[model samples]
Target: MKTTKILLAGMTALLLASCGTHKTLMEQKPAPGDTPRPAADSTSHKLSYVQHISDKALYQKNVVSNLTFTVNNGRKDITVPGILRMRKDEVVRLQLLIPILRSEIGRIEFTKDYVLFIDRIHKQYVKAGYNDVAFLRDNGISFYTLQALFWNQLFIPRQQRVSEADMSQFSVDTHRLEVDGSAKIVLRDGKMTYKWVIPALWDQIAHTAVSYTSPTHGTSELSWFYEDFRPFGSKQFPASQSVEIHTPAIGQRPAKTLKASFELDGFSDAGDWEPFTTPSDKYKKVSVEEILGKLMNF
Candidate 1:
């Protein structure tokens, strides 16, 4: 009986050890400060600092915003301000306030399938299919123009790989952290040729600055300022942001300066952001020249 009891006690201890080991493994969470995936990986895009920044320090509560932007088309200078009202599931109402011909231009809307532009002054509208918005062929990738659309498919974590700094030409530092189940990335890079600062604070770009040498542009540089961070529902970012891109206009003695600011001053529940839809009856078949004149308001 004594020998049998010893074997039973040993078996019971072994079983308990196995159970404890399983429980520990189940409780394990992803470690903080893990690096974002590489840039070449299609499933791991979006460089962030979620591994470095502390979430408890950056949770913004109850904030909405308006964005004001300035654009210099070389021939004319303009300021455009946009407002975003947030809703559940990251849906939002984006309103663009444009200043044109010394007047406040009407709002433009963007939906999943189309781009809508409305001329409040002329009571006319311009509609472009998502496919027609491309200036070139359907390459499936756009560097800048697509910046207008901040889609989760385009900017979300793990959607694409993050680019690495060429340490031979530049130095880099990155930090990441997790907060509220989201990732954040902060990066800084510099070299003898140029310098840039990207603060992926709380997975949102807090600020960015870039400078480089150009033979024609003559050492062009741009700086982006982000502030007034507010949270709309679950989304959080700057309520107002500004960008300045400067270059030397050929005839202008000093470099011409282009400054743009976007502010999300106010937002409301606009339901779904349907791209502006233009009615077919509003457009009449006309000659190319006539269409050009109409577009130019001639």
Candidate 2:
């Protein structure tokens, strides 16, 4: 009887362990680091520390890199060789190519004035202002927001850049550091919330998430993860990055999530490529929705 009781106890422990592992795997929240620490003593001091970190991590200049770009839309996954070009505060362009031949297949560019997309495979293109794009219009996201995410910096909406004076708007939470030695800095504007997580022993941003909630439009969140840092100038740049966007179900559309991952081969400050591309007359001009649907389906 004692041996039977022992066997039952062992099975109960195994069941509990399995349940715990499943919970950890399914949790959407960022994991806390193993290290622990207390919150900062003063608010002003914390703000100053974040500002200093931001200033030191800034990378300004034209950058070019060859990257592996992968996009997953829950149902399907596709990856292709690509090139990333950024002309500081001017434009960000991504060109995806056919794997072996290295021929261009698609291009997406973001500039201060407009967003441009070229579907070389279909000979279609989309050139429109942010307000004209449904996703951008609904989320209140602008070119500057995209710029900040790519550059790994903080930003304020509707503004071209976040200035020193704007640093006061952000709040820092150090309590999590006690659990894992990482810190979370947050800024809230109306219904939009922006959060950046800095890992322990690192000055650069390890992750960033922007979330928007609205009664009429439902809710959405964009999370960006940075890893594989490499030296650029005097600062470290993320050589690998991934972005995931989650949108709540709206009517019959149902819920949807889109994820994109980029692994850069190398970094450069070269500015050889043209910053803008004007679609040729042979390409048909399509609605943003049509072009996006085709790209997503690809």
Candidate 3:
């Protein structure tokens, strides 16, 4: 039971850490005499760059991968073997297994309608809508935001997906190319700011950072880094990824930060498994707050 709680708590930390805000961590300004000249000095050039980046989204209908999931939530670090499965616009599921034995221990599933979390060892679960999750509700994060991060694509908040017309909302900067041969794309929506770093030579997104500020709750940030590109379909996919979140203190809660890293052995587009899971009667359902309280106290 103790081990089960710790594992679940670690997973919760990762989920919560995925949706937050931070001050810009990377410098967006070009260094003196180091700015890379734009491909052309016209609006069409900027639009072309945005179109190129937007086109990088993988068109696969299903993706599956074997991964090593690691999380550090201030107190301790836990690493385990996991499986990640995703079906475009349908669901994203992650199953964590017991090492060596490879028995299922826990799983978290995000669908278009709700989020489901299961603890196989305890036969317990939590199912809630996006609004029912405090962190997600307060931060304006939804299923699509997570989907964008996991799929490594550009996104506009409160939208199901980014469209060709929406691409205009994002501004591309070539100044950073001189610094690291990467272009920076930025978008601002209300209090939230998003930035993506992409290598100039390729259209793939290498890093993403989202920051939010609130006069009442302070500021928080979520940073996702991607590496180790491998061929997938007609495009390249990142096999190594890491997420870092820093959230400001709210009420009695002190400011907190957590990091979750995922290293995938490889990628697959097979879709043999079911996309949804229905918990049997043997499993007990719990409230989101109940789970969040337990994880926060951990």
Candidate 4:
């Protein structure tokens, strides 16, 4: 189990996969005893209770660091140190490091046109567009969905793109749920539901859940949960976050899942991000099939 966990976590090559510090924002806590926080953003103010959620411009660009990264699926549990820097419509770059030696074990860079994953220790990498990867070519995975998830904004599947107007039209059979004193906004549309709630004094989205179903591929679920809200420049960002993805069994194949959790020890836009450098001729380049097969064998 441990060995399999290592390989699965390390090969998470596709593990499909926020902050703070304003005095006015920190004035109140999302929950009692928590620090104070700035009032809601201008965008959040425009929408009603249910409308505030689907705010696409939820945040501007920012970098985050000092994190403990982990990936688990009951069978494997692996954790490491990591860092991330992302800007909406620009890029999302991440690196996982070895603790004691502070050596970088892996890194993945995402851009509008492409996604790159590199195994620094082994010098293997995957560089391709979502369409280039046959497995995810049909899945509701895209630069926009990722951008929304990391930016802490609401997202809907297969809607041309992420925008405030598009979301406004997403009103289907909608409803709400009050859990633990917080109202969870649930919007059910066609074979999916988008649900979330404001955590405390902070105004932005703290959590998002997305479930999707297809007759041919079975059911898949993805969620992002936040914690450890801390002050950034003028806003508070969740310092700790957990992202989960699950795909149920289809046909004869078994189900698969990946859970990744991370905490931010550092948050700043101090580093540079670039596309993964093309490997030298000495390295062999393989197709997505080759990469997936190798990962399974690992």
Candidate number of the best TM-score: 3
- Cα RMSD (Å) per model? 23.3, 12.9, 4.2, 7.0
Between the candidate structures 1 and 4, which one is better when assessed by TM-score? 4
| lDDT accuracy of residue 135 in candidate 2 | 54
Ranking by TM-score: 3, 2, 4, 1
The numbered model that scores best in lDDT is 3
Say which prediction, candidate 1 or candidate 4, comes out ahead on lDDT. Answer: 4
User: Candidate 1 lDDT, tens digit per residue, 51-76?
Assistant: 22212122331123555544443444
Off-target runs (Cα >4 Å) in candidate 3 are: 1-4, 20-41, 177-181, 200-202
What TM-score would each prediction reach against the true structure?
A: 0.42, 0.83, 0.90, 0.76
lDDT of 2 by residue, 223-272 (tens): 77888777789777888887776667777767666666789987999977
Task: Give the clashing pairs for model 2.
Answer: 33-180, 36-178, 37-178
Give the per-residue lDDT digits (tens) of candidate 4, residues 185-297: 45566666666655444555666777777777765777777777676665556787777766677767677666778778867755455533555556555566766665554
Evaluate all candidate structures by whole-model CA lDDT and list the values in order. Answer: 0.35, 0.69, 0.80, 0.58
Clashing pairs in 3: 21-220, 21-221, 22-220, 22-221
Question: After TM-score superposition, what is the CA distance of residue 12 in candidate 3 from its true location, in Å?
Answer: 1.5
Worst 10 residues of 1 by lDDT: 17-26
After superposing candidate 2 on the true structure, give the runs of residues whose Cα lies further than 4 Å from its correct spot.
1-39, 292-298
Residue 222, model 3: Cα distance from true site in angstroms: 0.4
